[model samples]
Target chain A: MNEPYFREAEERFCELLKAYLPYEDAYQELYKTEVNNLPLYGYGVKGFTLSMIEAIMNITNNKGDLKLVEGALAIGREILGKPVELLEDVESTLKSLNGDYRLVMATKGDLLDQERKLLKSGLAKYFHHIEIMSNKNKEDFQKLINHLDCAPEEFMMVGNSLKSDILPVLQIGGNAVYVPYHITWEHEKIDHHITHDHFHQVETIKEILPFLKSQSYLTKETLK
Target chain B: MNEPYFREAEERFCELLKAYLPYEDAYQELYKTEVNNLPLYGYGVKGFTLSMIEAIMNITNNKGDLKLVEGALAIGREILGKPVELLEDVESTLKSLNGDYRLVMATKGDLLDQERKLLKSGLAKYFHHIEIMSNKNKEDFQKLINHLDCAPEEFMMVGNSLKSDILPVLQIGGNAVYVPYHITWEHEKIDHHITHDHFHQVETIKEILPFLKSQSYLTKETLK
Candidate 1:
């Protein structure tokens, strides 16, 4: 039930590093290198794979063993082959809200990866629009909303990441719902006390249904 | 005047193989390897870079030296750092069509790379929608038309690749204008005799202007 594939790749890297360094220290160093190489490689399995190779080069002092390169290739092949794992409530949430409100998927992901994942997730038909954003910044949200031809208040964003899907939307005056998954992406973990009229948090995607239904009711019946 | 950066990377890979094999032999082998890895790496600078490493491994019998990996790393870094080189008439073409047609960019490309290029290209202002498709198949075209709320005939695809941009669109009953870029992506080179009512081919992007203008004429004045 809990086989997150990226963790498998990370653990593989850690194991590869076991001969030279401690696990946590190696992980931190690897993460740092990946972050530093983000601009060059962008993101997704290919970038992750490339960063692993780069990290190996750094750790092994540019004399990275051929076997380690083999490991990196294996890691890349494994990650690329891994199937998309949709969150439990994601399909239900999309089904509930798809028709009533325009459902758009905005992701800062690899084009091939996200598109493949969308196909694999069996959730493509539920979305009115599927956008692969370069970054999830305030400007990106504003551009997305403007392109959608929807006002900020009328457009609501829902996702698991506060840093990406929440803050940027809120900053741009769009409504946002935070559906915290059990395992948050490390980069998206933020400690913020939010007290906004427009912001709401839920433990899972299913929990957001009530709030959305009521809010949409107000929008259709009251606002209209 | 033109330094297609990807070519530079290719040449570097070729040079690296000079010690072991003939130039053209090494080049063909690398090309074959890169094509094979397309499913694994997808299409992008990262994929190309990874394929080079894989090719090196293949060529060197998995006894690939550290210098080869270093060469691949440098190639990846160099390619990623290269700026967007907008075609000469692309801006002019968009400028001409922006007001009339609901211009949408449909690209089967790496999301981050395309987005970054779009931003740098500064032609983002012209497009009403930007779609990064996973593939350029007939079904992909149909889906895009459906999402755009337009009939296949109402949507016109303007692109350089005959394989990706022309055949698929024509197969889906969409209008297509092919502007042949001088440097055709090797994978997109297709020898097809296109004799269709909805297909038009031009040497340069600027040539598509008159066709599009006259098309919008038929769409607005004649048809409506």
Candidate 2:
């Protein structure tokens, strides 16, 4: 994905997640994991793990086959009592898939809110796997690399902030796209240098979509 | 003056100035006469002479106690109407009146558009003496210093660009507060070395009001 557009989308998605998720701890856990790279403590880990299980269960359904993703299709109808479509209007924007490109998300804490929301929201159908962890240091990032079975250069990490999204990916020689957020909490502060030459700065999210589609390494035709 | 706050206000004021005066040639001329050491062209010299006439006319009100000064002010007023408000605003913001300080404007043309507007806008009440120039270069800047009878250290330059505002001021051993505009035109490109430094960035116009009010060389209390 183009760096600017992906960053914008990720920022918007995070904002929506904050509104939908209950409890202060959920927000704290999410921020720590996604923004601060801090470890998830006792309840946070369990809560996150449970949310992921809920998401997976919702995806499987009783039919035992995964359906192609549709925007805004709510998963976990049995528990939530209704289908919730979180992905909304942007469904048609996603590129058509071929099996060559595997989609994955590396997040801190156990998969909880985002995973469940993604499946419930019908966004989970696009990704093959999601990795949720309590830590996002060098070791965890390396583990993610191994799990994905992809080289650093081959994968592109997209997120908000130069501290979290850009620094680690750049350290590993991976391409990273940063989307600056309008609002950042105090806890998200991380010591990171943002030299003009090191990273690309962009104002909006949609600008990156064309770039992502153009990159051959992430495209189905190139993979085949 | 509080450096940070003054910097912010100076930036805001510069942004407004750029919007009202967007031509590159005018900006170059203004810079050449006001900051850079260079000689004024025919129209620029005429404009400067006319401005001196207007200043004298304002003091003499045509009754000719200072006929030479009044004559100069009349010619200056004929060339530049009320744009002098820009200078008056700066004068009103100065913190004290102990030393001679000159008003230098970096613009891109031979006419004093900003100076005329300030006078016509009913803002002239705040300023006593004014100098208007369309072209500013190193030599013109030196002439301005001589006209004001002050050393470069005792002087300050307020403007919007690192290339035009901060760099030249620092080169002359003068303090400068840069107020960056939200959008910059293609013609205003600066050397990469100047913008890379964090010391020069400012965001707002109101922040510098207090800083100017605190300066010992200019009197803010008397200005109002």
Candidate 3:
């Protein structure tokens, strides 16, 4: 996983929300309306979707009925023309991979904007499927494994986080390769559960090719 | 910056060391040595040199006498060997760069083994100089900066640990591009001082090229 997605999403949402309403006022109102169950009287569908996604992503802990108010505010902000900077290299890196592996993206927040960006950049074709999950838990792992119909040993989770992708995959008996992201968020804590043999952490995503080549299952035909 | 070096060095040193000493006896002798006192005994000039390199690279915590001892033991176990595995790739990457910049290699520990390897592998020509220090601290930084006669801002420190490379460089107003090593030894603590700045916490050495290029400081003429 890359840092740009979450950082950009948060920034875009914050900027969009701030434009339409006073930042603090909007935060309070959204909190009361969506999270506090004060009734979202004037909010539209977009507002509701954003609130829900924010809640799922755990950005807004259920402090009150206003729990998802932050989400609604973010959604409103995103819709009002906030510029979310796209990661320029992401598409290029994805395009250059020579492997036949499916890309199931696991992210921590609402990815509607990101999904569209991928499509626009023509990177949607490379992935067999896409998944933007709020968390990396047993349920998410099982869902991913079932989707591929592959055993844990056969599956490899590649991401920039050892706390998220690597640890979860290792816990579920799957292989994981960590490509450390340049910018790590404050919330992504190091998993203390990580054993020495848990996962292979490499510096770049490109390193994955050589690692895969080392594995017996990755055939030249499949990789090509 | 990569695990292969330590692994290879460990292996090569062990193979060569074993030819001269019995493995079990070496282990018994090595285990009794103190961690901070590694360079006291000559395990093998090459083995000790590589061990020093590994130690300085922050790959292992065994310092002084114990570093050589454990390194010898590890070599005897066949877990580490001369980093022949990475020689081709390292050479290839170096070649791909087309001698764009003078490589100033700064490594922790003693420099003899690595120097020998570099010379043998024909990588010595690419580097303008190589300095091996027990630790990268204020003293070492000042010395290198003075020797190069370059401003702190003009130089970039590329290495594995944040505690060592990034923080010290940043403290002295020099830029640091961190290429995280594959395996972080237990001693390399996460620097609590790291601020949430993307410009500072570099995940790859390649990031520096573009950054330097943006400033017109990485031109062929400047490097030469």
Candidate 4:
């Protein structure tokens, strides 16, 4: 993110909330309320945008301020229209791993928004296919692993979020390498530590190549 | 669904518009604007809700009226929360076809919204797994067919919308059965007649059972 990504959205949303609510932690309250709305709204810009509007309404005591709604809409449109930015070494790492391994993208979010990001990233061609899920739970991983015709032990997931991409995979007997982003979503933060035989934490995308190249990634070489 | 499906939502949105503007066809205007927003917002109630809010802003000259926003959210929530009502004979016909053929569900919409509907419909157990796409175009169908390990000519799709479900499948050399719904979305309405060897039209869900039972579904037994 280089200090300029979702944190940008959060700052803008905080600014929007501050214009209406007196509390300094008003934007944080939006997160708490959104966690409650996750089951109903799920993840994505649309859900987040809706949550912002709902929070605005709640904070204003249903006053329906025209200016606040307009500001919220503008913030949402900006986030939705933001271009996809690739992490450093992502393209090179994919290029290095492309010919030897079969790659698939398993993502969870608004269908169109996820597809749009993939399309704009220009990395869609490297994947065999895209697997879109409602949530990244144990069952979702099991179903996806089954559908891909692979055993859980043989399936490896490389993603940025430990909550969605790492813990569930570890719970289901799969391999997961967590590459934490600098500007992670607060909802994805975990208070506890993870210690598993199949879990590895890496500092960047390119570091996984050495273990993968050995074809025996189960070793304790990269465990943090 | 016989009388109280999406039409109810549309009527509610129209009522919302009538309160803010003097136009008799303001909800119709919502659909027109939504068509233009499809590329950005895609399908499902979330997209529809966003389009409604955007339409209100435009119609009100960016006034962003609080009442209209609340009304739009109410209508969107109603559609999102409404239980999935099975079509007549849907359960019985699916039961009859079970175990004899590999049943699959190919759907499109918001990721969580579609999952919610499938879970609510109690039809999730009937399919091998769900296939959710952003759209139902030829490319989407072709990719799904490829994923399912079936040839285009051997694959069959049974859906309600001609523009989305039938034409795209036929265009890609696949078989399709059209079962028209009573309250068809105007956006899904087609103006042309279809005459294809791979196409069949049925009035209800159970009507396809006869040809499907014979296993020679390509035979000219049920043209109408």
Candidate 5:
């Protein structure tokens, strides 16, 4: 539930470039082209790393050295290898809700990378199912709901990104609780001006407990 | 069980390059580097396409044009979009084995692309489960076996590549039946000198039926 994904990537890119101008320029071009072209080029740490290297080369007006390319790729691999931090109170919240409802972790990324992270996270025991998605669009949410054999009104999603985690669920008639992460990827950010009966914005992951309690979404048996 | 995967990719590459020396040179270099670097770079259609584009640019002594890069990526996307043809007797063979044993389709590729091809293939109904793997190493097989809640000995893998489908299973103490495809990726090629009690090499998909029947692997209910 916690990922300063873009921030971490930018930090790594800046560290590799060691020049603010090139790093800034590369970041700008990468987000502009790569985000829009993700469906065409596909999405993952590997593609992002390659795109960043290409952007840096173009902005610096230098054909990059092979060794330098290897260095940048190493950063990509590092990003994949790094474990994502869980939001404070995430485990307790999951523990409280575990048997009351089926807890599932739904995230989008390279399958191997995500699977490796889950295995390393020490959070695998909390989830009934772990779904690593390629993309999180409305249709993907619909497919997941179908797979679960649950009515849209009975499904609830909680995550940091409005575009990916909230809007898709609301669109499919499912309840969604938005827990804003400290840092959000530009690709995942969107205007939150719309109104919906099933949507609520919260400051942190822990707030979802009281919100769900207020909404009668969870039974009192496990609330203790 | 039928895929001209490598052949088609090479044809597309040669057509784009229109020069044997560079094509051969790029292909050799790409396999040498990409395969060795797979654990770091990760594997999939997108990564392979990016590596090929980088390879071509190096061999041709030119920075790749954006349009040319797009064309090469289009080739990769094309491969992902192309559905593998089922061998002539595959449907009948699967139908016979359908009830006798659980059928699962395990393939390696980009997640979205593979899911798309599976949806388009009209062959999704034959398998009880579908696994889209990032790579076909023994560890990946071990993970699958763990997920399936079965021991290695209970598994039987049948596929086109000796490296991917057969050897990994054999190494893990699982039964493997190798049904060689007409065209195999050079990277997937390996010497088939090893033998085990559970290993069988068949000429085609139909031959597997008779072999399994003789071995008493299939229940008599289906063999009749």
Candidate 6:
């Protein structure tokens, strides 16, 4: 879900918001409200951006400022259009394990927009299958596993959001790697962190290679 | 799509809003704003309801009032969860044409939400395929036709929205029956009227029977 590059998008979204509002913590408030209301509105760059702007306009007492809101939305479109920078060593890393693992990019967002981003990301060639889910709850993960025809123990989930990436996968009896981003959405933050045998935290995505090398599932034939 | 009974759903949404804000034209304002912002926020009762509430809160200058907004969103969840009643003779009409034509339920909204409604409607038995698209435009329709392995002329689209249902099908050279609902979304209204040889307008879903019977493609073998 994080794709190792979405944090930059989030940072850019916040930068764009700063141009319209003078509030220093506008992004923080925006993230909190967007997460809280995500179940109601669902997920997408467009909906999330609109929600963020609506929150900012309300807090700043600029509710009637339609033009300002439009400006903010336009910025959101720009953010979505912005090229996603692949994290350091991401391409080479994924390419190395491409055949060794059934790399499926499971992401959730607006269908059209997410597809566009995946195309723009230029990293689509490394994965076996791509999923753009409407929601990433436990039910969604179960469906994905079923579609892949793999047992939960064989799946290795990796992403930046604890709520979307780590928790649900672990709850479904799958393995997961949590790569913490510098700036995370408040809503994705978990109050109670679980300690599990299959759950591993790494400083960077590259660390997952060594972790996988230690797994019995990684065979030399597939690694070739 | 309206599914015939969405007007009642819209009416229910408006009624819920009236409890929080005493504005006579609130629903109208809500609908207008919603249509205008549909492209930006995308569609689905949840997103639309959230946007409408955001608009009301903005106009009423109750920006920090999160509880009222939450209440409104809850109403939106109810709208999505509400049972959709088919138009008069809709099921029978569709059932009659069910085999004669490759009946595909093509509507746009949140994927999971739309699927839930389709399953709940118990109308899933009639259609050969059901598509809940992110957006209903020429390209989207083209993709659906391609997937169905049918030519544009072979497809007959029956839906309520002109913006989504009628125009695109006509533009793609598909036959279409316009079954106008009593309340149409403002965004779905077309600026210019279309007169095409393949297009027919009927007051109810039942009326489509005679129109389809007139078509040479409606053979006894296919119908049986």
lDDT of 5 at B62: 53
Query: Would you list the C-alpha lDDT of every candidate in the order shown?
Result: 0.77, 0.43, 0.50, 0.79, 0.71, 0.70
Can you tell me which runs of candidate 1 are displaced by over 4 Å? A1-3, A213-224, B1-3, B211-224
What TM-score, to 2 decimals, does candidate 4 have? 0.91
Each model's DockQ?
Answer: 0.62, 0.00, 0.01, 0.56, 0.30, 0.15
lDDT tens digits, residue span B12-84, model 2: 3233234234444333433343332112122232324322322222333433233243233233334333223
As a whole number from 0 to 100, the lDDT of residue B1 in candidate 1 is 10
* Global Cα lDDT for candidate 5: 0.71
- DockQ computed for model 6 against the true two-chain complex using alpha carbons: 0.15
What is candidate 4's DockQ? 0.56
- Give each model's clash number: 0, 61, 27, 0, 0, 0
Q: List residue ranges in candidate 6 displaced over 4 A.
A: A1-36, A45-83, A89-104, A111-116, A119-130, A145-157, A170-180, A189-224, B1-39, B45-83, B89-104, B110-130, B146-156, B170-175, B191-203, B206-224
Give candidate 1's chain B TM-score. 0.91
Model 3 ranges off by over 4 Å: A1-76, A79-89, A96-99, A191-193, A196-198, A217-224, B1-224
Taking the tens digit of each residue's C-alpha lDDT, what string does model 1 give over A22-89?
89877887788877877766668788888888888878887767778878888888877777777777
At residue A47, give the lDDT of candidate 4. Answer: 76
User: Sorted by TM-score, highest first, which candidate order results?
Assistant: 4, 1, 5, 6, 3, 2
Chain A TM-score (model 6): 0.82
Off by over 4 Å in 2: A1-93, A96-100, A110-114, A191-199, A213-224, B1-224
lDDT of 1 by residue, B1-224 (tens): 12367777788888987887788877888889888987666777778878888888878877867778888889877776677877787788788777777888887556677677777878889988788777788998898888777877777788878898999999988888887766765677887588898888888888876675676533732211
Give the alpha carbon lDDT tens digit for every residue of B104-200 in model 4: 8888778898888888889888787588889999999998888777777777789888999999999999899999887788788899999998888
What's the true lDDT of residue A60 in model 5? 49
**Number of the top TM-score candidate:** 4
- Please tell me which predicted candidate would have the highest lDDT against the true structure: 4
Tell me how far candidate 6 lies from the true structure as C-alpha RMSD in angstroms. 7.0
Positional deviation of B154 in candidate 1, in angstroms?
3.1
